[model samples]
Target chain A: MTTAATTHHSAVLEHRDRFRPRQAAGKGHVSVRNVDIVFDTHHGPHTAVQGAQLEIQPGEFVCLLGPSGCGKSTLMNVVAGFVKPRHGELLVDGQPVAGPGPDRGMVFQQHSLFPWKTVKDNVAFGPLMAGVGPREAESVSRTFLSLVGLSGYADAYPSTLSGGMQQRVGIARALANYPSVLLMDEPFGALDAQTRTMMQENLLEIWSEFRNTVLFVTHDIDEAIFLSDRIVVMSASPGRIIADIRVKLERPRQAELLTSPAFMALKRECLALIREQTLHAFEQQNRKH
Target chain B: MSVKPGPFQASSAVVPSSTGERGVIQADGAATETVVGTDAVGAAVEASHARLPANWRRYLVRIAALVVAVMIWHLAAVNDLNLYLRFENVPNPVVVGTEFIAQLSSQTFYLHILHSMERIAIAYGLAVVIGIALGVMMGRSRFAEDIILPYIEILRPIPAVAWIPLAILMMPTEQASIVFITFLGALFPIVLNTVHGVEQTPKVLVRAARSLGASNAAILRHVVLPGALPSIVAGLAIGMGVAWFSLLAGEIISGQYGIGYFTWSAYTLVEYPKIIIGMLVIGGLGSLCTLLVRKGCAPLLRWQKEAGRS
Candidate 1:
């Protein structure tokens, strides 16, 4: 089922590759080498990401594309410095990742907006955390919210927002940090297909304006192929980068690009890699059970 | 941001609940998956909603029934039921109502009510102050929760009335004993509710405060305290109810002056009308005080149940 889905994804992406718009963010790069993540579970410490290495150049969009249980998110966390690898290092801006910091802002699959806080306040959280006064935070937050097309939702609470709108606020909050590196883990994986596509386009548009290095994680090959300047296909369980597909696409890419051949070609290749990895991971789990 | 919490929210268990260890995820502070309305979850929720009693009809019926009952009693008493074997001392409903009104004018009766209310007020106030402090402390700290909780649980089952004899013996005077009895009644519910409220304060709110650079004290003040307000008010309501009941019982058992004492004194003289009037006064005061407490707490607890659906 997954293989067929991946194939379909690749076909669509190949169609969009005709118009894969590239943005210039060649100045900021993220480097990860043999990043190994082992989490302690009830049975034992399980290795999630293993020997995953990738070089995401500055101002370029790179997607860590893989199926669920492929450790795509763990790798993103490793890059963001939110997770420390048991072996090897993940670097941002030529420095080894240590702990979560302001330089790399993360937007998770779930919108982590504070429920009691207004949209403006949620967007301003990072600035406030960084000791910016309310006046300064509000000013910066408004700009980001406006960028996310949420200028009118400043005083509204997140509960009032549609899923798509909340995701926009999440993106705004992450962007408001003014981070050089943006790390997103399945950020749009929860959205409906239509909304997800809209967000993908919105993401690229935002990246075009801000022009920062982004390490986006997703299970969707089409999404990776469409949005990423370079796509890193990861294997399941002990995740490793199997393929680094460079999307030869143009800048300011639109929805119409999903019909192009080049995009489909990359998507097909990544889909094949992800299906094999996911099936194998499932087998490994079944065997252990 | 739609942070207005749902009405009747029973976030009974924190997220990742299957794991026994206290791993709290404050959904209140974080955005949860606008959970896809999977058929299974939706069906279960619908079932629960359907099972909920539509009690408005029952409530109206109960009010009607109570009115009918009162009318029956007034009619029974007014229509010569007191004439047969019942002594003239058993004043009819009209005479009893007159006596109640007359008693309200008498300075002696007013003093009796004043003494009873003053004792209950002092004890209930003390219970509120001390119970909340201890409860909040226990709720916040794991060590305190462990140390103080067992003792509270052990003492809670014992009736407040059971402490009357001990209170009378320990206190130097009857008034002090009465106050102590009220304290016994009010203390447990207040402390338990406060602890539960504090304990249940969303960890996410606390984390949100932490992320915003709020200090520990600030987190407690801005998040935990406000988060616990509704539950604390609920506790106050329960504790106040208990205090008034205990006050009446204490006055009846051992008192020189008070409504309880006056009622029993009237009973000995076969003045059933006076006894009934005393009961009426006690019931009226209990309800009025409860209303006052509710009024006082409502504004402070304006954040109560708003969001309904998950």
Candidate 2:
């Protein structure tokens, strides 16, 4: 299925290849070893994630599926080097996760594009910071902008773009550095149902060509089912990987296949696991209150 | 640019080069042009038409208000009206107008205007430089804030006028003293406003820039400075007004040649008409200077105007 999709989408592959980041140092192999994250609150120390362990192979599409406050985002942040684990080691491409770097491209939930910059500059930012010359950076931006189908909005500011377009620009900005891994924190969570569905499919199309590792954090089981090659369901509060389910769905999964028997079977299993975890979490919160 | 940033913007996210969604792209293209063309043209026309008559009306009302004020002043002065309120022997509009026209032709009048303008230009320029630097430093660093804030708080309340005696004693010359006073007046507003602006910058923006691999210096340049600009400009506008206030006080007290000096000398000589002319000139120049400051700052703040969020 993957091979067929590759042949079928060779045109897209050409465009994606032309615009891929200069240093295609594709080394997105993430290793999380006994990761524990704690936050200081007024009440006391609160464990967000405890003894979390996972291994993500380079070029693999994976989703950390869980209920909100389950520390999925915290774990992702640890990989992105925004949050340091209180205890344990996080390695990306055998390098220690030290601080936020261009090596891991991040697409935030709110499409945190710099509002002051034009769309082109926003995409150019990663390359520019990595010491790319101004003209080269601009060319890099133009290529990626074209790849994201936002070639026309090069001069337009981010505030003027729609939410989805802004997120697309965000993706373009992140990918401009040719990062080994893309950390998306519910990139389409704010979109309407149709747009979210469309975004998921569009994302898969981009992913197919680039084949960069993706650690997509989301609570939506359908999104996980549709996008990921592997679904890692996290348990509620003090998040840990409870179940690591491999998705057997074929590549270039379409919206129509969302209702297929195999797809529904996988969705049903994820739904039950999430429902059970969510219910347990709710009860725990009720007792605390 | 014709793209409508609507919810369906996601549909455009579909690769047109890809085999699927060609019909959706064509449909979106035609619909977008129609919507953009009508919306842009209609909004432009409506905005211009709405602004034109209102602007004309404002100018006319302003002219009428000035005329009425002059008329009331003329009547009161000519009739020696309000004698009980001690408004007697005040210069009438005609006398002041005549004197103003006569003064405009005199070399001394031009010299006075030039001297006042030169003092303000030098002092205000210096104030802007120092104020912005200090403000940004204070806003960016806790150490700078702690060190500078106490002195600022102590000095801000002490009016520029109150600084006159100390300024005269400390400076080498009277001109230096007057310029120092004017600089002091403009400094506070510019610094305070800049600090406020910088501090008010969104934390998310800083984080976003950081995550994008920008260093601290880059974040300050790309994020904090632009974010803080609108407030800094507002501070500069206010600073110009306060600078003029101090400029007048400085000129009146110890000026060798300025509008304020002319007005003070007129009072001493009992040349009431000349005093009134000086007052009018001073008011005109003060407002003109502030208008210039606002205009100068406008280009730097184009992002705010273009946002059209309001």
Best by TM-score: 2
Clash pairs (backbone) in predicted model 2: none
Model 2: which docking level applies?
acceptable
Scored by lDDT, model 1 comes in at 0.69
| Candidate 2 lDDT score at position B114 | 95
Q: Where does model 1 exceed 4 Å of error?
A: A1-36, A51-60, A74-106, A124-144, A177-181, A239-241, A273-289, B1-64, B79-92, B107-140, B170-184, B190-230, B254-271, B274-306
Give the CAPRI class of candidate 1: incorrect
What is the per-residue lDDT of model 2 for residues B155-196, given as tens digits with 9 covering 90 to 100? 888888899889989999989999999999889878887888
DockQ of 2: 0.27
TM-score of model 1 (CA atoms)? 0.70
| Residue-by-residue lDDT tens digits, candidate 1, B119-219 | 88899999999989988999899898899889887877777678888988999999999998888788877787677767876643454344344566766
Window of ten residues with lowest summed lDDT in model 2 chain B: B17-26
